[model samples]
Target chain A: MDWISLILIPAIKSLILVIVLLTGFAYATWFERKLIGRFQQRIGPNRAWTFGLGHPIADALKMIFKEEIVPSYVDKILFVMAPGLAIVPALLIFAVVPVGPNITLFGREIPLVVADVNIGLLWVLAVAGVGVYGIILGGWASNNKYSLLGALRTSAQMLSYELPMGVLLIAILLTTALGTADGAGTLSLVQIVNMELPWYIRIWILLAFPLYFITMLAETSRKPFDFPETENELVAGFQTEYGSIKFALFYMTEYLHILGASGVAVSVFFGGWRGPFVEQAPILGVFYFAAKLIAMVFLFIWVSASVPRPRYDQLLRFCWTFLFPVSLVYLAITAAIVILL
Target chain B: MAVSDGIKGAVEIAKSMAVTLRALLAGPLTVQYPEQPIAIYPRFRARHELRRYGNGLERCIGCMLCEAACPTGAIHVEAAENDPEHPVSPGERYAKVWEVNLMRCIFCGDCETACPVEAVVLGHEYELAGYSRDDLLWTKERLLEPTRPNVIIRTE
Candidate 1:
């Protein structure tokens, strides 16, 4: 392919992916509200525009019109940069995600991905880690004691949970190696998922799925684990001082991260874009991807509504004493099994 | 004592779970709101609407009885001399400007009961959200009956 075509193709595909992801995020909020409302025996937004389809639009308009407040005590530069820092990495992480297999479009065989890097999984982890800087900066810049405390809690929580998360990834890697003839393994999600393995072997990996899922929830700062900005406790949390488009950016970043996290979880655990009948039609890869995404999103909402927030001390102890040790033991067991079997 | 406490705890958990499990099996409690509103009781106090006589004239008569009965002082009534060319009511005076500060009004239904002529009555509406505080305060023009048909009246 020519240089122009190469750049243009990827750029256009990335733009399309971003647009699709954002639209899904918008509806996800609506879905969460509706689902949570039902769970609580209350009606969600129903009067925005024609059965609340226009609720997001109404919300966007309201946010746009709102006065962007910057407190006098805040560090203006970092406060301004924080939301962008949060959102950019979230968008970037999806670049390496393989949505589908290669398809011939107008005689040109186009890969259904933006950029399939060799170390896609590690890249995702790294970018996700970087995304925490936004929260940290936001908390510190706000100049409120609550914001600072929340930020500190978030930093500690993210750091603590990450150890287990990384160890779990190590377990998946070992499984991938055992499935392969050679000891060398691929960290790419697509490659790992495409491995032709028996049910018995796959079952071992399946056991680790819940552990990874719980860690992902904590990593994304989702409900039950969402203590950083718990409305009842922290008022508005880190972005309490933010307003207007800036606040909107933070909101958008949150939904985007949710989408990214769900995508990663589906790719890693349930097998990415590999549908029951997807072998017949490769195009069904998109359908499988969307189904998995929706299922994961629903799980997030379910847990959010069902579970109560853990106390801060309890959260830390759960991470260190329970999760960390369990994941380490799991990693060791998987490694031992792979070596013996 | 520990054994008894364990039994009591199990029983309490069972009771709570029973309530939850029964609710799970039952039909969804979600009221679709705009699509399907809940059945309001007959005495449900909502926003106030001005009543009209058979001849299409108002029945207020500038009495201010409802205004006096409102404990929150939400009602504001201005009396004006009735003109024969454009008489608004049967009495010598009519309410020129009727306003209700809904923020202050407790929806006690006292105003409705106090009105002898039943001119001011609360209608069936509970939605009262607004972008600003000013939007909540109802003026006479907004509270009056619509001149056109099929007009959806908003009430608090």
Candidate 2:
């Protein structure tokens, strides 16, 4: 294949991914508001024309039109660049996530994934790691007491959850390796999904799935694990000094990160773009991925609405004392079983 | 707080999930709002509207009962001796200055209950929004109805 086939096609695919993802991020806000509003026995934002569907567009417009205020005494450079930093890594992680299986378009066969890197799972974790830096930077740059506190909380919370998350992934990888008879387990995400029954679905891997989910929820800074930008204490967290489009950027980054986390979960545990009739009609893979992603998002929002934020100590304690031990033990057991069998 | 507490917590989470699932299937309890208008109770205390007597005279007797009843101290009434030539209120002393800072008012219906002559009634008009706090202060002029405009007032 020439450079056009290798480079140009992927560039086009990445462009499409970026456009779809940005649009998805916008509507994700509206969808979450609507669902969560109903959960609380109240109607959500329905004033934005056409069943409140235009709310995201309206919000985007408002953010753009609003004044971009930079307080007099703050770290000017980092404050300005933080949003971009948060957004970049979030977008970068999607490079390996395939929306659909390979298909022939205009007589040219192309893979659905943007990069299809062999170490896609590692790439996801690496890129995700960078996302926190944005929050930490934004929080520190703001020079506000609350913002600084929120930033530190985010750092601690994310770091704490990540350990258990890694353990769970390790267990999952072990299961994948053991599941097949022919080959050693693959690290490529597409291959993981392509497996008929992912290790997470098996009875042995069942325990790992829920723990992984909790870690993901915590990592995303959702309601249950939310301490970073909690409304009552932190006063909008790291983005306290942020306003206008910059504030909107942080929000967008958070949502995008949520999507990334959900998609990763879908790919890693639940079958990603792998469902009945996916191979026969490859386009259906996109729908499968989307449906799973939506369900994951719904679960997050539902949990967010139902669960009240725990005390700060309680949250950290839950992770360290409970999740960490359970996942580590599970990983140890699974690894031993895989090695033995 | 104990070992049982953790199990109880687990059960509570499941119970919460069941409740949410039930709520989801039951559909959103939210009204479609403007398209399907909200049905409020007839006795619902909302915006305050001043009333007038059959003789087309203001019903306020300038008694500071409503002012005392307001929990937020929103009402300020300065009563004056009514002009015999043109008596606005039925009593000798009428409220020359009637102001209600809605920002402070809690719409507790206490003022409506406290009014002796029923001059001030909490009516169904709760679209109170403005850029400034000054706009929220409902004056006597704004509160009083303008004789229903072109409608003929049949004097009993």
Candidate 3:
């Protein structure tokens, strides 16, 4: 194949992924509102065009038209770049996600993913890790003491949780290795997802599901783990100095990150695009993927409304003392089971 | 041991099923707001409507007090001098340009209470559903007194 064709394939796939991810992020906000509204016994944004589908558009328009204020003491360049930095990694992680099976489009067999490198899982982790830089940089560059304190708290929280997140992946890796024919392993998400196993092993893996899920929630800085931008302590946190479109970018990125995290969780645990009855149909894979993602997104919103934020000490203690040890034990148990069996 | 395990499992299953059974017997919780109307609270602040006096004269004196009280700046009002030829109310001035941006309004009831003459009041018709931003922006005419054949008693 020519280099041009190779480059064009990924470029086109990435463009489609961007459109789908952005649209999904927009609707995720709507989904959160509607679901949380019902939970709280109120009707949400139902008046903004066809069951409130246009609420996001209305919000975007308002943000764009609103005045952009730049504080005098802030580092102007970093302040401007922070939101883009936050959003870019969020958009990029979706490129590795497989939405469906290979399909022949225009007489060419095209994979459902934008990029399917061997180290796809690692690529996701690395991209997500870099997203924290946006928060840290935005907070520091603002020259506000509260912003700096919030950034410090966020950095520590993310760092503490990331260890357990990585350790939990080791358990997943062990399960994948045992399911394979040879003792060797393939860490590609597609290959791992395709591995079949008995109920005993499947149940064991499912037990660790909550660990990864909670860590993902913390990684995204969502409620219950949302100390970074706690409105009570920090006034809008890192984005305090940002306004208008800049602030909109940060808001959009938060939604996108939640979507990306949910996508990864579904792919790893729930079997990406794999349904009980629809595995044979390639097109149904997309439906299965969407359903799983929506369920995970709903869980995020439900938990946000139902749970209260943990104190800073509690958050750190839970991650380090509870999650870290449990994940480490899970890895050891899985490895022992694999070796002995 | 087997009997105990069976009894324990049955008890757990029944406990979960009891919740579903109660929900099924309790009837539907949904009110179907559009199809079947529900009673609104007496103090509920819904859509704004200009109140009329006993003699059918408008209560608003074009003070713009509601506009000033709005936290979201949703209300817009312009006062024009009332003339003997085309007088809108008994007051010296009347609101020529009155608009409420429903999109921005938080519906905090501050605007209704700010009215000095008790002209602006939130009604019980809470269904302020709209299809677009323009639809949400209630103009002076849409917000004026109800012009129907039958006259009803106004509840405070």
Candidate 4:
């Protein structure tokens, strides 16, 4: 029973999670292209099948058959390993994310997550923090100037944005914890989602939403803050030296990271899997969770499409000068309110 | 900058996003050619062709004005006396040899204008790709009986 509960179920969940994430990563590209195309008044990828549904398959085939090129005078091992490093953390970040409530399968109750650890939120933060290593190492190993510059930019950007994002999340957690029946705060994401909060606290947390949104965008290295891989200057940044499947792996990491970030955002803000008729039919919770996740991703894409990328100095200055102070003020305000209430 | 400036910037971004959303609703400006018939002007000059009168007599008098008028020297004409018993054209002389090197033709419509009897015309069959240069060297026979259908939209 212990083996079935602890190891077998989790292993099955992890396998399913990876398969779903990979497929999501593939189609996310298609969705982004189609949506951005519409935004620009252009039809995107209608050649293969209706509305280019088979585009991802065609792209995968192209990537697989492409010749892998390893430049001379490059650190071959780290260059090869960088993409793997980048993708592993991205995939791992989703492990703690509860997609839906516990459901009975084969006469056994199972939590719809790979891991529901007590320190689930901390795990997400830590795992997300590791994603930069892939970019840094990839850029460093390429033995190219542009790659190194991109890597350097990435490290700086991460350092600047991580603080506000962490602070905003802490503020949110404080509000959620304080508003609950018991004063004891929990770091488990599922518990946070399930907590019932009063209107004042919900409104207070909503005040922190914009800062969180900006930080999340910067953290994911999406457009408008994508200085690390800006095509104009970096020529694909860290991925300059990578080609074929290796390049595809890096591309997969970028999209999968977006999915993970969006999933976390949904759980933290949108009340994960909580919807009308969801409690009665737990299966509907999965659909709600998926719908929320897609909506979050769409918001991300919409922001990217709307905003233009800032200059490197401007990006850093915006983070340090504006975002950092604003979040600090927010955190101080939240702490004071919690103490007073 | 002031807080008001920041608010203004946010408002501007919202406006731009609204503009883009409106564009999204306007549908794509793409012309899906080959599947759909494209609208081209009636005067759109594309390929050269020879013409005939109602009586089926060739309109060309072999004047060679088109060859002179052609800026690229894409046209060539040779004239010959028509047979007394059966005239190839209403005029005494008819075109013995006429060819247009499409490789050099610029589709300027000068040849159409230069012809005294309106023997030459630019048609609406512009999909002129061929495997070799020889295929594009339209001779008298080819120009006299063009196989492709002309598609011209009369704006008037």
**CA deviation > 4 Å runs, candidate 2:** A179-182, A197-201, B1-7, B28-156
Write down the worst ten-residue block by lDDT for model 1 chain A. Answer: A35-44
Regions more than 4 Å wrong, model 3: A3-5, A276-280, B1-156
Supply the TM-score for candidate 2: 0.78
> How does candidate 1 score on lDDT?
0.81
Give the runs in model 1 whose Cα sits over 4 Å from its true position.
B1-156
lDDT of 4 at B57: 88
Give the DockQ-based CAPRI class for model 3.
Answer: incorrect
Output the worst ten-in-a-row residue range by lDDT, candidate 3 chain A.
A35-44
Models 1 onward score TM values of: 0.74, 0.78, 0.72, 0.96
How many angstroms is residue A296 displaced in model 1 relative to the true structure, after the best TM-score fit? Answer: 0.3
True contacts preserved, each candidate? 0.16, 0.33, 0.00, 0.58
The complex in candidate 4 yields a DockQ of 0.62
Residue-by-residue lDDT tens digits, candidate 1, A1-341: 69756798988998998898778777888988876665666566777876578888778789889988888999999999998898899888887777876777788878777887889889888999998999889999989988888788789988989999999998888778765668677887667767766677688888888778778888888887987888888887887778898888878878788889888878777777887777677788888888888988877876777667878888788778777888898999988988887
- The CAPRI-style docking tier of model 2 reads acceptable
Error of 4 at A170 (Å): 0.4
Two-chain DockQ for each candidate model: 0.13, 0.26, 0.05, 0.62
Name the better of 1 and 2 by lDDT.
2
- Local lDDT at A99 for model 2: 74
